[model samples]
Target: MRLDGARVLVAGATGVLGGALTAELAGRGARPALAGRDPARLARAAEAHPGAPTAVFDAYDPASCARAVHDAAAALGGLDAVVTAFGTVAFGRAAEVGDEVAEHLSAVNALAPAAFLRAALTVMGPGSVIAAFTGVVAEHPQAGMADYSASKAALSAWLRAVRREARGSGIRVLEARPGHLETGFADRPVAGTAPPLPPGGDPRRVVAALADAMEADAELLRTAPDGTPVVERRAR
Candidate 1:
């Protein structure tokens, strides 16, 4: 879809990928509203994109997610697109994965996206889209990543379900599963857990895929550095 004159809401605006996505959306002439967990970081990013809307939101909190979606839609006049790069990844062996780590990944990666999509659809009607970031681990599972892989797999499945439910609503749902993001996502610190970073991956190609698929109304599928794969899930 042509980004000009579009009103987009970007969740996880503070992260490396989210930061790049936000800048790309703004550069394309779309008004981007940032929704993040930290007000300070949101304010800093918002200042860079003057007059753009920003909201305090959490991926695990359904109420906060709903409020952020509605508030962003209202602030930007209407929500044309929503992109989520939120969630965490912990790289521990399946046998070593802890309850806290598993819960965090599940809540942020799976539950949050489902809840956010619900709120986004409530405000947006036709000609809108929802794109989220997933990882190739969902399909080609790894030995050292149980919680992370499962979370992304849940997201991919959930997006397929969303596409089915929103068939007549004119709202397209897409899941972007990129491999080995170079972004230091897994390098971050997490309380009560420790896991090394997965193989480094590219962020530009991933963001480009996200922009193109969401803009052009693609199906629920994953993207690789090599090219777009033919996933079995259907798109209406």
Candidate 2:
């Protein structure tokens, strides 16, 4: 879909990837409404875009997730696109992670984004788009990050099913599966310590490519072996 003058809501806009995406969208002439958990951070994020709307929602609360989408769509007059770029992670063996931590991961990483996107569907129409960020781990499960991988995988499956359902309606669903990025996300794990990891990819470049994919109405944004972002016109 064309982004020029498009009304887009970016949930988790206070996060690194989300913030970058919001800026990229705005730069491309799309109007972005920011949404995140913290009111202060949401306000600060909104400052960058003078008139961008802001909404607050808790990841664990499905109603709030739906509320955020409707609120942003209302403020934007109607949403042309919506994207989710926030989640929590836990690093540990499958058996070592506590039940609560595992539950949190499930809620934030999978259920929350689905909640937001499901709500987005109600307000969006044909030619509109909805996207969510799922890491490469979703497709390639990793050790010491079992729960995190599973959560992301759940989200990936959710998007795949939704894509099939929305096909006839002409609403595009994008799943961004970029590899590890230099966003310091690993440093702030909700539980356990991050194992030794290779250097991460450039976040700015990833977000730029994501914007391009959205404009092209592509279905997937993945990372090539060389760490370059690749937009796939088909979802597989």
Q: Estimate each model's TM-score.
A: 0.89, 0.99
The 10 consecutive residues of candidate 2 with the worst lDDT sum are 222-231
lDDT of 2: 0.94
Cα lDDT tens digits, model 1, 114-214, are 77778888888798888888878778777777778888889888887778888988888877777766677766635324445445556765676567666
Off by over 4 Å in 2: none
Question: Any idea how many clashes model 1 has?
Answer: 5
lDDT of each: 0.79, 0.94
Candidate 2 per-residue lDDT over residues 1-236, each given as its tens digit: 99999999999999999999999999999999999999999999899999888899999899999999999888889999999999878898988999999899999999999999999988899999999999999999999999899999999999999999999988999999999889999999999999998888999999999999999999999998667999999988
Candidate 1: stretches off by over 4 Å: 189-199, 225-236
> What local lDDT does model 2 show for residue 87?
88
Best by lDDT: 2
What C-alpha RMSD separates each model from the true structure?
Answer: 2.8, 0.7
